[model samples]
Target: MPPTPIRASLLLAALLLTSPAWSADPVHKEKVELTAEAPTHSVKGKIKGYGTAEYTLTGKAGQTLRVQLKTNQPSNYFNLRQAGKDEALFIGSSGGNSYQAKLPADGEYTVQVYLMRNAARRNAAASYSLDIGLRN
Candidate 1:
C-alpha cells in the first residue's frame, strides 16, 4: 500500500495540532548600580543641589521580580512602581542604606531614588546610590 497526498497532509496537521507551541519566553535577571553627586557648596559653605537615580526592569508573564536599593547616605528615599503607574508599590525613608521589594506579576517596572532633604533647608548635602535586580 502507498500513502496518498491527502493522507500525508492529514498526518502533518495532526502532529502540529498536538505539539506544544514553543514561544520564546526568556527569563531575565540582572542588577544595576547608579551614583549621583550633590552640587558643590556655595560661598557661605552651603550645598545647593540634590541627586537622583533610576532603573528599569523587564520580565515575562507570571514571572517573579526582586529589587534591591542601597545608598551611601542616611537621608535618601527609595521607591518602586510599575513602569507607567503613578503610584509606588513600595517606599522607604530614613532607614538603613539597603532596601528590597518584589513584583506582583510580569511586566516592566521602575525604581527611583532621591534625596530626602533640600540643601537650602539646613545647608545639608544630598547624594544617592542605588542597586536593582530581577529574577524569575
Candidate 2:
C-alpha cells in the first residue's frame, strides 16, 4: 500500500532525528610559541612603551594544558586567559623569562605579554621571544 503524505513526512523526520549529525568539542594538545620586540628607548634611556605577544590554545573539556614562556630581559610580565577570564600568570625582573600554567577547560584561550615600562634608563629596543607547550 502507498504511504500517505503525513506518514511519509513522519518517517523522514524520524530517520533524520535518529541519525548521527552531532559532534563533541575537539581535544587539542599542542604547543605554541610567540615573540615580540621591545619599544625604542627614550632619549634619557628609559623604556617607554611595552611590547606584546598573543597566542590561542584549545583542548578537551577536562584536559590539563601547560604553557611556558622565556624572555631575554627584565621587567616582563605575562597574562593567561581561559573561557574569557584573565589572570596574571607570571611576572619577572632581571632574569630569564619563563612561566607555566594549567588550562581551564576545553575551549579557546589566549596569552599576552607586556614589557614593564620601567626596565632601564636609556630608551633601547630589544627582541623578546616566548615558548608555549601543552600536555594531556
Candidate 3:
C-alpha cells in the first residue's frame, strides 16, 4: 500500500533525525562507569542555562531504580532516561526531589540533573547533589 502524505513525512523526518549525519548527543553524556548490580549511588554537579549533568547507569529490566536530588536552591531537580531515547523515563522536576521506577529495559540509562523549567528559562545556575540506586 502507498503511504499517506503525513506518514511519509513523519518517516522522512525520523530517518533524517537518526541519520549518522545528524550527530546527536548521547542521553548520558557524562558516561559514569556504572554496573547493574553495583550502581553508583551519588553524583553532584552544577547546571547553568540549558546545561545538564547526565550520568550513565547500567541495569537490567525489572530492576528498581531510585533517584534523589538536593540543592540549596529550590529549582534544581533530576530526571531519568534510557540511552538513545529522546523522552524522559521518569521525571522528578514537577513533584518533589526523588523518583523510583522499575526499569523496563536492559541498557545504559541516564540520570540527568537539571534546573527547574523557569530556572532553566532564565539561564540560572544551580548546584545539586543526586543519589541514584539500582536493585534487581
Superposed on all Cα atoms, the candidates' RMSDs to the truth, in angstroms, are: 18.2, 16.3, 8.7
Cα TM-score per model: 0.48, 0.48, 0.68
Tens digit per residue, CA lDDT, model 1, 35-70 = 124111111111123434455556554544444444
lDDT of 2: 0.48
Model 1 regions lying over 4 Å from their true place: 1-48, 94-101, 118-129
Identify the leading candidate in terms of lDDT. 3
List the candidate 3 regions with Cα displacement exceeding 4 Å: 1-28, 84-86
Indicate the TM-score of model 2. 0.48
Residue 81: error of model 1 in Å? 1.5
Index of the highest-TM-score prediction: 3
TM-score computed on alpha carbons, candidate 1: 0.48
lDDT of 3 by residue, 1-136 (tens): 9999999999999987785833432232566655666575676677776667888878889988888888976887777889888988877766578888888888888877777778877878888888878776
Model 2, range 1-136, lDDT digits (tens) per residue? 9999999999999987784634322222233432224211111111124435555655555444444444455565556656555544344433235544455466766655555666523433445555555555
**lDDT (0 to 1) per candidate:** 0.49, 0.48, 0.76
